[model samples]
Target: MQRKKPYLQPYWWRLLFRANGTAAWEAMGRGPLIPVPNAALTRAPLEVWADALLEEAPYELEDLHGDLLLECYAEPAVTDGTPPVYSRQVRLPGK
Candidate 1:
């Protein structure tokens, strides 16, 4: 049987935020595209990171909503040219 490695394929991510009902969106950040094989490992840290970003003062949480896009890639910048494997959008705190 093949043993599972402690670290698995890294998940790539990019976070974008925009005003409510707006077409314009800006890329706020992206996690280091490193291998993290399991989805369980990826979810918590990425979400925590997003929550932290929203808390930062630079962003005016009001009128802002965003989505976290995640894709599993074996290597950095692989661009397998596919849709994100996972995606979720949330409204930032404030109106």
Candidate 2:
């Protein structure tokens, strides 16, 4: 009998936010990309990072499809030995 391969899901750009510096550092060490949600009142940390990264990135904003945009955020933490925090935000073309 032939076995079927599992369906692979497409990856979307996520906007993650860490309220505190420590959480941000932890997230960075784990992976370059984080998950986020889209909201009007508040912006997620991941959104800030994504925006900054995209600014330096060569990819055109128009390339990002409407379906791929994701925004996320987390509570900030307090602790020593925390790395410096950076913000990134990605705006779709014709915002």
Candidate 3:
């Protein structure tokens, strides 16, 4: 697990599961968080697409494994500013 790039630029996709706010029991993301290209992200309105993806995410968390009570629809990982950088993305109005 120590034989890969040591730095992540953010915006890459990953599978994350948490046991608590503290880093007591956590497995690292299986891949590097490389900076996603503008041609690879989903087009906005990001909220709509995100909600749709969230609808199909795996969120059946068990009480003995995780403790984060986030959204209940799907279980999508939150992205900071990634949806604006995806493929075929149109420019948002008003900058």
Candidate 4:
């Protein structure tokens, strides 16, 4: 069976350098990041998409990998509603 050569998407080197610097190459000994175009990313919710990406990301720095992928889009901003507000754990006695 022929082994297919790894595909490093355009500008991935720059992104990886910015993300982990030379240390990444020294550690991993190989780079396998593939830039998924905006037209390719799924329309799933941000959190769900993030979880899936994190689970399957080939890069050691998942956060950076995810960010870099998102940055490829023209607009990486999230148009969802604000996150839920959580109240402090202080004692609120009203008995």
Q: What is the C-alpha lDDT of each candidate?
A: 0.51, 0.37, 0.35, 0.30
What is the lDDT for 52 in model 1?
A: 53
For candidate 2, which ten residues in a row score worst on lDDT?
Answer: 20-29
* Residue-level lDDT for 14 in candidate 2: 33
Candidate 3 lDDT, 1-95, residue by residue in tens:
57864342234333334443456423333443433333333343434444444344334332234432212111135354434333221111111
- Runs off by more than 4 Å, candidate 4: 1-19, 22-44, 59-95
Model 1 lowest lDDT segment of ten: 65-74
Shift in Å, residue 10, candidate 4: 24
Clashes of 3: 2
- Segments in model 3 whose C-alpha atoms lie over 4 Å from true places: 1-11, 20-30, 34-42, 59-95
Candidate achieving higher lDDT, 2 or 4: 2
lDDT of 4: 0.30
Which candidate number has the best lDDT?
1
Measured against the true structure, the TM-scores of the candidates, in listed sequence, are: 0.46, 0.21, 0.28, 0.21
Q: lDDT by residue for model 4 over 1-95, one digit each (tens)?
A: 99986543222111222242323322122434333433323444333434454345444453442123221222223233522121111111112
Residue 31 miss distance in model 3 (angstroms) = 1.0
- CA shift at 51, candidate 4, in angstroms? 2.6
Model 4 RMSD vs true structure: 16.3
lDDT of candidate 1 over 1-95, digit per residue (tens): 99986654445655566655677766664454544435655556644544454456235444444433333333456453656645456555544
**lDDT measured at residue 42 in model 2 versus the true structure, 0 to 100:** 41
